[model samples]
Target: MGTFTHGATEWDVACPRRPSRVAGLTMAGFRVRDLDPLRMVPHPAVTLLLEFGAGSTVLDCAAGRQERGSIVAGPGLGTGGAVRARGVNVECVQVRLSPVIARAVLGASPADLDGAAVPLGDLWGREASRLREQLGDVPSWQDRFALTEALLARRCAAGPPVDPEVAWAWHRIAVSRGLARVDGLAAEVGWSRKRLWSRFRSQLGLPPKSAVKLVRFDHAAHRLVAGEAAARVAADTGYADQSHLHRDVMAFTGATPVALAAEPFLAVDDLAWPGHGTPGRPHVPAGQRPVRGPESAQPPH
Candidate 1:
């Protein structure tokens, strides 16, 4: 069992395999406040979302798709690209998996996993309902950790091999780095930018650059709602400027930065980690960043 806590939220994680809890399946226990509507952008990682709320109308992010209503998956959900959820309340456990872990569990390519919300039993057999119910009784973070281990034990008994290196790199740069260029990252990983792009797309379902944008804006939205200055966040997260940040935020969230920042009903406690729940905006030191010309503020590779 591994644990990391921040204020009202805690990621109580566990795995069946030794030395690397992150290698196999893991679950994060989340408790957060309600939030204003925000967009779910694409990422380098595939996610299995299980909402314990009443219901949500998720906007299908692919081309030529429309928003559709989704239900609580007894076992949970599997899909890709950005999604949207409106009018959510406290309490939910979001289960996310690295591409390597997803491949090990599903025995299919990440691209094959893309689609609207599917039944958890469609993939997890009949134990889906039991698993969803287990979330309610979990008291300590350790219990959450143990639950994840037991669940993964059942799934991984027949799972495939997972590349620890690839999973680590994906979580580190694409998941943790937020929005940033991957050119330098490619060089550091000993893979050409083209090769990295191909692998990232195949394993995670989206390019690293796109994933970074999603997470960056996700973080930005939280901060903007928390009353952080748009200019400060834009510069800190590698956006070209305030306007550049505004456009991306609007594109991803369908709301202006100012409007998002001024939202009265939004709260950080309602968001799931690596998804939402970032406290007040991240404060980036002025001298610690690179300066860009007006022309450079636009989005680019």
Candidate 2:
């Protein structure tokens, strides 16, 4: 766990040392003593927030929707720049699920969420309450992680898996950091362009083109957060020019590149998600065995 003080609030954030037993899942823990509004940023993964704290965390959406307690947010949240969170004495376990495996683990299709955060209780019924109780009863962060993993493993086992073609296409997009062409993906998957677009959007909550743009934007955003110049980042990340990168940054975050570079949400990713994109995982071509582990896992929502 790392300790940091922002203004008057003290925060402790922890990431699990052990990778999740279930493929396509990653977990982190957070405890906050003072309340501060956390600016939620858009990412590619579906997020599950499980709270075991004494006080509930409140999520305010740009569309005027609000939610409290444990919640689940789908991919591309905060694209409208309306999503923010605040809590007092908050303790929670957050899981990021690959859209490929999200249906299995979350028991709902990502398309249903439409980039909104919903209370977990609404999706899982009593199970959400039970999970909070179970997590709160645990004494150590490892234990909480283990329990959460076990629950996800069980749910994944019982839920439906994504189509192998869809999974392969998603992996390709992720490995390429969203630079892969949709037409190339269609060819690789042996599906017609129309078919691939429809299926990808229906299953993953976004069309193939949107996925590429979002993934590419995420990569560029992080590079900016790492202090890279906009022009350099654009050149390296496949953006046509600095202005194109700026437009994308504004479209996704409603903030300039410089302002987004200093966002706490993106800054904390290094500490919260170390060894994020592990290398050495050979790329399996479309229709091959599905890749496993965090390398193939989706990004945070």
Candidate 3:
């Protein structure tokens, strides 16, 4: 376990020593004593936050909605700068499911989430409660992770997977860092553009174009957080120019690249998901923040 300190935000973050039994799955455990008000950035992955322990996870949305405790949100939950997270003593296991396996593991396509967060209990019923208890009861982070992985593997094995073609398309877009074209995907998959578009949106929660933009933006945002100039980031991440990058950043974050560079959400990435993306993970400045003893597990609410 390590402490992620940036500006005024600090948290205890832990990563699994090994990958999940199931593919296309990644997990991180977090604990925060005082979670600073942090904007929720859009990403191209399904988020399943399993809040446990004594504290809670609270996400306040721009629509006057607030989600507390364990929640499942689809890809791009905070699009257009719509949500912020703030709480004390927050702890949880955060899982980012690749869109390909999200359907099977989540027991529903990401489209069912409708770009909002659903209480885990709403979907898993009693199972969600039981898992919460189990997670809290576990003796160590590794044990909690093992239990979580076993449960996910079981559910994924029993559930129906997305269409293989759809999975392939997602992989191409993800690995290409969102540069893949839908027309090419349709052609390579031997399907009509209409059919591919419909199926992709139905299973992946958003349209193909949106996924591309989100992934591209995620990459660029991380680069910005790493302290790279917006101009350099825009040039490297396929943006038309620095101004285009600035506009997109503002649209998603309601903040400029300079301000975004100081956010805890991306700053924590280097410690939580060091292997986040291909080509190379973002530098994500650790900066000169002070570090101290490791903190115990926490909750998010």
Winner by lDDT: 2
Tens digit of per-residue lDDT, candidate 2, span 1-301? 9865665777788988877767678888989866588778798888999999587799988757789999998889889567889988889998888888788888889999998999999889999999999999999998999999999989988987777667777887888888887787766666678987888888788888888888888888888989999999999999999999999998888889998998877877777777662211223223434333324533221
TM-score of each candidate structure, all chains considered together? 0.59, 0.91, 0.90
Give the winner by TM-score: 2
Better of 1 and 2 by lDDT: 2
Predictions in order: lDDT: 0.49, 0.81, 0.79
Q: lDDT per residue, candidate 1, 104-213, as tens digits?
A: 55545554555344555556654655665675566754565577566765564466543332343454454444744466655444556786677766765556676666
What is the TM-score of candidate 3? 0.90
State which candidate, 1 or 3, has the greater TM-score.
Answer: 3
Expressed as tens digits, the lDDT of each residue in 101-174 for candidate 3 is 78878888899998788898988899999999999999988988899999998988788776655666676677
RMSD of each candidate? Answer: 10.6, 5.2, 11.4
Candidate 1: lDDT over CA atoms? 0.49
The TM-score between candidate 1 and the true structure equals 0.59
**How well does candidate 2 match the true structure in TM-score terms?**
0.91
> Model 3 Cα displacement at 44 (Å)?
1.0
